[model samples]
Target: MSTSAGAYTYSMASNYNRVPKSKVVGISGSEVIELVKRRLLKTQLVKMFRLLQSLFQ
Candidate 1:
C-alpha cells in the first residue's frame, strides 16, 4: 500500500485562456472590430459632451 501526493507540475500555456496572440494583439478581424467599437463609442461620447458644453457656454 502506497499513498503519495497526487502532485501535478504547474503550467501556464497548457491552461492558457487562448485568446490567440493575434487576437490579443488586436490584429484579427473580431479584435479589430471590437477595438474600433470601443474607441469610436468613447470619442463619440466625448465629442457629444464637448458640443453640449459649447452650446451651454
Candidate 2:
C-alpha cells in the first residue's frame, strides 16, 4: 500500500493535448505604478548629475 494519497502521478502524456497556464505571484496594479515612478525618478536624477559634472569639467 502507498504511504501517501495521490502519490503516483502521471506525466502530461496521460492527459489531452492543451496549453498550460502560467502562474505569477506578488504583482498588482499599485505595485506596477510604483515601479514605473521609481524608474522615471532615477532617470531624471542621473541626467541632472551628468549635466552638473559636464558643466564643472
Instruction: Residues 1-57, candidate 1: write the lDDT tens digits.
Output: 112112232112121442211211135755534321212345556877999999999
Give the total clashing residue pairs for model 2. Answer: 0
lDDT: worst 10-residue window of model 1: 4-13
- Enumerate residue pairs that collide in model 1: none
The residue-level lDDT of candidate 2 at 9 comes to 28
Poorest lDDT segment (10 consecutive residues) of candidate 2: 7-16
lDDT score of residue 4 within candidate 2: 21
Q: State the displacement of the C-alpha of residue 19, model 2, in Å, after optimal TM-score superposition.
A: 43
Off by over 4 Å in 2: 1-39
RMSD of each: 17.8, 19.4
